[model samples]
Target: MAKITYIEHNGTEHVVEVANGMTVMEGARDNSIPGIEADCGGACACSTCHVYVHPDWVDRLPGKDSMEEDMLDFAYEPDTQRSRLTCQLKVTDALDGLVVQLPEKQI
Candidate 1:
């Protein structure tokens, strides 16, 4: 299992144990992490699951695909370097202590 830590805009953190092969969005949704609406589920069709990858761990994640890139363009605060659709990040042992910072708002 991978341990995913979600830090809300106000700095509150929610830690969830995610099974390998599951997306971050799924983990957040399953754990009821308040900020990750994930309206489009894990389809990469919405920016509701937008999150900022902790700068130190960015390189550990995979590069975004075109679809995720397009969706991110509509994010509330698209960060060229750290912004990502959580739906696109799958949990893995390599991401055991993955920490994602939530945006102030999802709109």
Candidate 2:
């Protein structure tokens, strides 16, 4: 398992143990991390699972696809380089210490 940290807007942190194959959103949702709502359950249909990848980890995740990019346009707080739909970030051993900063709100 790898450790994934979910940081709240107020700077509070929640760390979760993520299995190799699960996505970052899954790790948060399963562990009851408060920031990621994951309203579409990883389906890429909802932008409620929006998160900001730590600046250092931005290059670590895969580039967004058309569908995910389109959905992000509807995200509550969107950013071109930092914001991401966590549901698409699959966990990996290389991401053992992945940290994500949450936006203030997710509509």
Every model's TM-score: 0.97, 0.96
Q: What is the C-alpha lDDT of each candidate?
A: 0.91, 0.91
* lDDT of each residue in 2-28, candidate 2, tens digit only: 999899999999988999999999998
Model 1 agreement with the true structure over 1-107: per-residue lDDT tens digits: 99989999999999889999999999998888999899887888889999999998878889988999999999998899899999998888998999999999997
Per-residue lDDT for 106 in model 1? 94
Model 2, global lDDT = 0.91
For model 2, the run of ten residues with the poorest summed lDDT: 30-39
Deviation of model 1 at 43, angstroms: 0.8
Off by over 4 Å in 1: none
| Per-model tally of clashing residue pairs | 0, 0
